[model samples]
Target chain A: MTVTATAGQPAWTHSLFRSGWLDGSALNFFLEELNPAWSLVRPAVRIRQIIEETHDTRSFVFKPAWGFGRAIAGQHVGIGVDINGRRHERRYSISSAPARGLVTITVKREPNGKVSNHLHDRIKVGDRVFVSPPQGDFVLPSPAPQKLLLIAAGSGITPLMAQLRSLLSGRYSGSIVLLNYVRSQQDRIFGAALDELAERHPQLSVHWCLEKENAERFSASQLQQRVPDYAERFALLCGPAGFMQVVRQHWHEQTLDERLRFEYFGTPQPFKPDDKPAGVAAHIALARSGRSIVAEANQSALAALEAAGETPSYGCRMGICQSCRCRKVSGPVRNLLTGAVSHEPNEEIQLCISAAEDDLVLDY
Target chain B: MKKPHPSRALSPQEQDALAAELDALRDSVVADLGERDARYIRRIVRISRYSAVFGRIALMFGFVPLLWPLAVLALGVSKILENMEIGHNVMHGQYDWMNDPRLNSQTYEWDNVGTSDNWRKTHNFKHHTYTNILGLDDDLGYDITRITGAQRWNPGYLLQPAYNVVFALLFQWGVALQDMKLGRYVLGRRPLTEMFAKLRPIVRKSGFQLFKDYLFFPLLAGPNLLAVPIGNLIANGMRNVWTYSIIHCGHFPAGVRIYTRAECKNESRGHWYARQMNGSANIEGSRLLYILSGHLSHQIEHHLFPDIPAHRYPEMAPKVREICERYGQHYATGPFIRQFGSVIGKFFLYAVPNLQRRPRTA
Candidate 1:
């Protein structure tokens, strides 16, 4: 049946009617109230199961309520929760492949981490948690490379596991090697899964470098010994800052940086000095709020504003995301990321990364 | 210059101490902020949208006659709730920490014809800052009514009763025009270019609203187009009247005091708190009534904790009232009908110069 637009009726009229107008709109509203996962902003998911990987680390499997688009292997999603009346968000890599019909996020509880500790201690099966649709560019490249090397340490095995699972499932015709580093055998995540996959697939090789047990560190020689043609492989790395730094140096020295991909879970901690620049306090004037706050040389504008009980909109809390960008109406600011001092008036700066170097006015 | 009534005066040290105490109250509330507030607003938003859409659809069947009144009533309630409970508090930055762009105070635009940007400047900053001080708060008489005796009496006020009725009928339009400062334009205090720039959004919003009600939905009804437009008119009129009554009761009740610039000179935080309490009145009602009023029923609490989510006001009101009592201040509150009646009475009373003696201080 050919359907044509009726006279005096716009093209959208039929679609609007088919969409059920008020009933359709009401259905969406009702579903959203029932669970935010039905909405576009931040769809929610329920924790289906929790698997303990280590004393401090666990994997949470989730079943999203609705409209959770597929995430490519090695991507991450932002997880948010309300704890004691405050909403906190943190991004975690998906550990499960898209074909799994569920998503899993492996988390290692940090002593001072708010969202991580909350997920570890408070979250339980059947509890709903809000999550942004999967995002991040850390996914495996299109047209898979002929050779691949996956290196991970601590809780960083998550995204690599996803890639490994997907590659194995896709029957990837490539030489694949996984070098997993942990404190001990007990600390290794997905140990049995890796062993099973290696045993089943002749092209897949698995190596565990137990730092405490074997007293071994990741080096180019060690990597070469296991995967002789390591130089010809596309490498993926994830781990603690120290481990990642060492691996980065190794890749740089070998001129393999072009073939290497990595992702950081959080912003790198700035090196601290015994004493901050003495008497270098800069006054940050919030123009809209008509208030001035003192920002020490060690503090970012965001930290200073937060300390002064001012809430400025922010997300990611990292320079990579521009959510915290604000107009710097006046004065000097030092970009913590670029290590460049800017005195340009009326320039926009990310509050999360810019430190007040001189008296600054911000359109907060 | 007039001073604060001697009975209400406090030493500088006392004022600072009281201000610190009030600050502590605000700090405590801020610290206690959480998901419940977010959930409360989200629920209201969902309900408002559902009802509004349902009302519009019901009006499509306006030819049925019986459904028209129900549709208009539903639409009116939905619009009122959206403007008051959701839009007002959200735009106050109460839920800004949620980081949802739709609910951000700096970004949220209400369903009303009043532009959110203008409302933020006029209502959020100016009115909240000035409360009921005569010259500073243009809301004292909406620059038109003669509800406060402090406002200069003129022959123009003799027509106040007629104007008051007209104002009530078109309260939303008046609010839209309020920020435009039409009086300033007429008096040549504001430039024509600036006035038009300010009027641009107002005109655009009003045009869209008119099209949605008088044109789009009505035309969608086809043979019932006339009935749908009439239904829209009734709905808008109902919303205006209801909003006007609630708003007037909040500030114009008999016991609610209006302040002068001289009385509030160099006002400390504690003094500001006192003025807010004196300037605003609350309507006592059931939970349903409170919800219907968009929690404006707790206007005194709203004035004090303007940035806190309005849903939390009822729980906070008693504590705020206790603090006021401890400071020997009056927290005006009464039933809705009594408050509305008192406001109407005050409107008539202030129409002419007071035959009664003026306060000695003034």
Candidate 2:
């Protein structure tokens, strides 16, 4: 997000800040006490309402603070909250329409999720939260497709729900099919809203795949029976990794990958040391400091660096804060949180949650 | 010179037990850190920042007689709060767990002329790691004053009492210059080019401070230029002297110990804790005074757990004293005047020669 010097201030005030005679951060520091929502640069939002969508899920509606920019529906926004005395940030897809002045995010509490559980238990209406500008590539395609197939499972319905709300509220003339999967009736989110919309709009079709009711699992035959034009329509899929993996493989086998877009939900399970062979070590080289350290397969990069007498800045030790995020110049590293092996060069990784997969080079 | 009195020694087993107990205390406190700690620091930041803004705005109306002194006092309090309570503690990574970018140790820049980077190196790492170790800790005498009797007496030290006044008046500049190690440059050890390279960031940082207080803000006060700049100067001087006394009282009080490098080598965790307890003294005062001093009044607790939040020092202080009592370790503490008086006494007592010696070893 651009922090243009006090946007509505006099031209001279902008120049004053630009000239370094006045500091924007210092001004923001003073103003934050008066109103947590007020900031010179950073975007902040105040919780205005909360909606219980399910037994385990709730939707938070936020009013943007002054200087907070607009967020498009279907895009993800990073919401930061202080749990205990520490701040933790997590990204969630905006579940509200861009036309709405208030932004909403639907969150499902995960058993082991620090941020999700904190938001569900501790956050209240009128509390302030820091927000990142709207992000992610999961947004709806421009010049809306004539025939759209939307698939979601569990909490993955958030972004697709937003796309559906935005599209249905507007003058877009299109045939939309929404397939929502849940475990039981109580597990379904936005059930009433989706039903109301489907009844009001003739072009919209709502399909509920309740697993507890022994409904047929998603398959080629079932998809074909539900939507005869599914192969010809653009599809957006979001679900648990397992569900998406199956659907993705099916689409790839059919060479229909280009017609489908997908996003993953649910936490990636943490790495277990027992999975690795004992006595294996990864060599990590610091590019700037020219120091090399050896880390065991179970050791986080932060721990290894500290053991080598390097004082890298870190917070929470867990991957909650991005404070320890630094550039990985080369080689592979496994995210301890998800056990996902990342081979991308020159990408930023959190030192606290990353274990060297092999010989690695880092920009310290 | 008179050396510090040696205390009762502990067995290696006793030292290990001491380490475990202190470690337990630290862990318990850390586990309990939550909204209360975050709120305390945020309140301090709010008070410091608001005071600064209000003080500067008040200085703009410096033409009013009563507002001038009040503005200067406000600015002085603001500077003390920022430098001591907020800046010093945060730069020690005390509030880093909060994960607020503003409170981060690595990037926090205070209102002082000293750059945070320099302070982190010289103060946090060097001074803290070698609290009272001679030659190794730059803060032993700040490379200027003969703070402890461990140092050899010199004719130069005769003027230390006189220079100590000037040093207090310009403590921030003294701290900013500490990392430069200018003594080497003076003695023709460090090359002028190398010194200049190290001097660049300091000059840039202090230059901004100078311009802001003396020129920029004064210019903004169109009619009452003299009062604004003058008020700013006195405000800065107040902070310098106040911090100097607080720091000096903590480190250089009469009963504080000074260790030789040989004696401190390869020390264990508990041994290090013992050394810190011996080397630091605490000032007793009301809660407000502790806040104003940035909780440095509990210097013993701070030395033990530098990264722990300072406001937690009070609650931890009584427990720490109890531990010290059980262990038979001297936990030095007294009222502010008594502590400051002892520090002042050390200034004169350490300046002259005293033929006395004490044998010690690690």
On TM-score, the leading prediction is 2
Cα lDDT of model 2 by residue, A103-178, tens digit: 8889989877777788888889977777755666776779889999999988989999889999999998999999
Q: Give the per-residue lDDT of model 1 (tens digit) for B51-153.
A: 8878888988876768888888889889888888887777776776555545666546666677776777778767887889888887888998888666778
lDDT per residue for candidate 1 within A169-267, as digits (tens), equals 996889899999998978888888889999999899999999898986788788778778888999999888788989999889999899999876553
User: Each candidate's interface RMSD, rounded to one decimal?
Assistant: 11.8, 8.0
User: How good is chain A of candidate 2, measured by TM-score?
Assistant: 0.74
- Candidate 1 chain B superposition, TM-score: 0.94
Task: Sort candidate 2 into its docking category.
Answer: acceptable
Instruction: Looking at model 2 chain A, report the run of 10 residues with the lowest lDDT sum.
Output: A1-10
Clashing pairs in model 1, backbone N/Cα/C closer than 3 A: A37-A44, A85-B34
Candidate 1 lDDT for residue B211:
74
Model 1, residue A286: C-alpha shift (Å):
14
The TM-score measured for candidate 1 stands at 0.77
For residue A136, give model 2's deviation from the true position in Å. 1.7
The 0-to-1 C-alpha lDDT of every candidate, in the order given, reads 0.76, 0.80
Worst 10 residues of 2 chain B by lDDT: B353-362
